[model samples]
Each structure stands twice: as structure tokens, then as C-alpha cells.
Target: MDPREGEFVDRMGLVMERFGGTRTMGRMYAWLMVCDPPHQSLTELAARLGVSKTAVSTVARQLELTGMIERVPTASREHRYQVAAGGWEHVMKVQFAALRQAVETLDLGLAAVGGDRPEQRARLEETRDFFAWTERDADDMLRRWRDSREDLDR
Candidate 1:
């Protein structure tokens, strides 16, 4: 990789780390974003990123689960991966799902704590409200993205 490309990968790693992902995940994502073919085998990714195949595989699975990347089917045994289409919208959808789950968990917690304990109830309520709002906002954002995409396509 060129020095500039390496720097970009490193910066992506830092950004992912800030958001609770491993550096390898970010680097792989960055590479996929700018790679020539836009898809790569695990071995190729590992070699290019200078990481172990196992590490690359693990992060790739994580990214796949999070809707950030996808495993491309191949005739060969070795699977290929690529950045998913509609990347940002997909990410927001995944995040919205997570926030919905959080709200469910928080609701349970609030019920468990009971309304008698004002402080605990208040705290859980506030957190739950935040997640609820975030979920709604994510939905709205995705809707807007779709509208803009349609406009651009037209």
C-alpha cells in the first residue's frame, strides 16, 4: 500500500475503534471502500491488511453481522467479501434495530426496578426515552435517504 493509503487505513481504524470496533475491522472496511475490485477473498484481505487470516475472518464476520459488509458467494470454497450497497442507510437501519432492542431491555429494567424508586425509575425512563427517540430519528433519516436516492436516480 502507498504511504497515503496506509495513513487512510490507519485513520479508519481509529474511527472504528472510537465506535467500539477493532482496528482490523476499520482497516478492512477502509480497504474495501477504496479497493480496485471492491471485493476480496479472506486471504487477500489478510495479506493486504498485514493481518492474520483468522483475524480478518473474524472481523469480516462481525462486519457482516453489523450490515457493514457482506460475504459474496463464490464457486470456490474461499468466500469473498465486499462493502454492502446502501452502506450508510444499512448502518442506520442496524443501529435503529439495536436501539429498539435497547428500549425493550430498558423497559424491562424499569419494570423490575418499580416506580417506587424515583431515582432508578427516572434514570431508566430517561435512557429509554433517548433510545426511543434515536430509533425514530433513524427511521426518519433512512426515509430521507431513500427519497434523496430516488431523486438522484431520476
Candidate 2:
């Protein structure tokens, strides 16, 4: 693998790991995102990610089910996986949804467990606040970047 691709794999691995997913899955998804043709056959994805074809198939299917990716129909029998065309938009949307779900889970847990549990509730509150802040900050940054890009284009 190219050095740049390796870096991409590593970075993606960190991102996925931080988000409660496997590092290998991150590398696999990142490879599909940046790879030429923006798609890969199961065999090719396996070779590139240094995993088994079955593993690639499993991961690819999971990603597809989660709307992170999709299958590209081909004349050949083998299936191909690719990053969604909207790319970061799609990925961030999923991430945000997951974050929101986590917050909702925390809410339910807090309600069930009661607010008297100071330590556990503190942790949950911290996590909820962090994700909420991150979501706002990311949205603001993206908006500014888009505005700047639009200005440059004019």
C-alpha cells in the first residue's frame, strides 16, 4: 500500500475506534473511499485491507446496511463496495445520528436509574455535553468553510 494510503487507513482507524467501531473497519472503509474508481471487489478489498474475503464481505454488508455505503451492480458475479457519493456528508450524518442515539440512551438510562446516582450521571452528562458541543462546532465550521468556498468560486 502507498504511504499516503497507509496514513489514511491509520487516521480512519482512529476515527472509527473513537466512534466505537473497529480500527480494521475504518481502514477498510477509508480504502474504499480514497481508492481509485471509488469501489472495490471483495477480493480486491480483502487484499488491500489485508483481511479475508469473508471479512470484507461482512464489513461491507454491515456498512451497506447502515447506509454508509452501497453495492454497485456489475455484470460480473462479484460485488463491489464504494463510499456513498455524498461522502463526508453521508458519513457525518450517520455519526451524528449515532451520537444522538447515544444521548437518547443516556437519557433513558438516567431516567431509569434515577438522578441520585451522582457519579454515573456525571459521566453521562459529560458525554452528552461533549457530543452536543462537538456537533454544534462541527456544523459551524462546515458552514464557514462552505461559505468561504462559495465566495472563492464567485
lDDT of 2 at 152: 92
Q: Write the per-residue lDDT of candidate 1 for residues 7-56, one digit (tens) a residue.
A: 99989999999888899999999999888788999999999999999999
Candidate 1 ranges beyond 4 A from true positions: 73-76, 112-116
lDDT of 2 by residue, 1-154 (tens): 7999899898998998897778877888899878998888999988888889988888888778767788999998989988875455656766766767777777777787687889988887888778777766777766776798789989
Number of colliding residue pairs in model 2: 0
True-structure RMSD, every candidate: 2.4, 4.3
The Cα local distance difference test for each model comes to 0.90, 0.80
State which candidate has the highest TM-score: 1
